[model samples]
Target: MSQYGAKYKYGKASPSDGFDCSGLIFWAYGKHGITVPRHTAAQSKAGKWVAARNARQGDIVVFRIGRRLHTGLVADKGRFLHAPSSGGYVRMESLSGVYWKNKIVGYRRIV
Candidate 1:
């Protein structure tokens, strides 16, 4: 399953009900029987960044979307799994899309 699908995509009032970005990662990892940190910033500090040229499935893609860090899971062909924002649902977004291209901070791989 795509990691984003396991959790709400956007417009969530709480972490449990809906996922922002990192929440999606946390939920997805939990589904695979692994546990990850909850907050985006904290999560960013947890993994080691890998070059996009070497990115693989399940690797974390971090973005500086605004004041906070936004994150997604690497999908095939330069795509990423993520929860976009309010009203957005879990989806696979292109890594080259304007939103992602402009804000991408780094990529990290955990396990």
Candidate 2:
């Protein structure tokens, strides 16, 4: 897993860099030599769907919010890495957080 706050620091990208939630996932995994789709729906379809109970490091987590789907990378424990629209930077967030807990659709493991 990346350093605790590595998600908040954009090494692969830039702090002022513009990236939506999926953009962060696509870029981070790419830095690690993993090629992922550019969008949440497509990314979700790219990996093998896994049960949340079996999720591990580097897994792709999918969320269903309203009519839109969101995607992020698993960090560790119950934390996940994502570029939130409000935050405007990639950061580690809790899976059990109300925002995510409510939207969690499923998880996908590409590696």
Candidate 3:
């Protein structure tokens, strides 16, 4: 939540520099001494997969919009937080929304 409204910075992770999708996830987990990959490709495969309907808060939410992979942290049953895109900011998005629902790859729990 601290990162909410932080502008997106491709490939960067810290709050000062802003964050890309997976970078947010990387830094967040690392903050608690839990190591997670810093890129979507690796991140999508690092943990055991879980069905989205059963995903709990803090689960890694994975999505593949066409060939571009995006990752974020689940904030609730149907909402997640992430740095959405190039000009976007970190924000909570609904998993059940049409924009995201079709793109969802699944969910993963790393800790």
Reference-based lDDT, each prediction = 0.77, 0.75, 0.91
Best candidate per TM-score, number?
3
Give the worst 10-residue stretch by lDDT in candidate 3.
49-58
lDDT of 3 by residue, 1-111 (tens): 788999999999999899999999999899889999889999999889988778998899889988799999999878999999999999999998989988988889997
Model 2 residue 16 distance off true place after TM-score fit, in angstroms:
6.5
48: Cα error in model 3, Å = 0.6
Give model 1's TM-score versus the native structure.
Answer: 0.83
State TM-scores per candidate. 0.83, 0.80, 0.96
User: Looking at candidate 1, what is the lDDT of residue 105?
Assistant: 82
Runs of candidate 3 exceeding 4 Å displacement: none
Residue range 1-111, candidate 1, lDDT tens digits? 433454564534244587787878887777779777888888787767788899898988888865988888887868988887766767898999976788888888888
Candidate 2 regions off by >4 Å?
1-16
- The better-scoring model by lDDT among 1 and 2 is 1
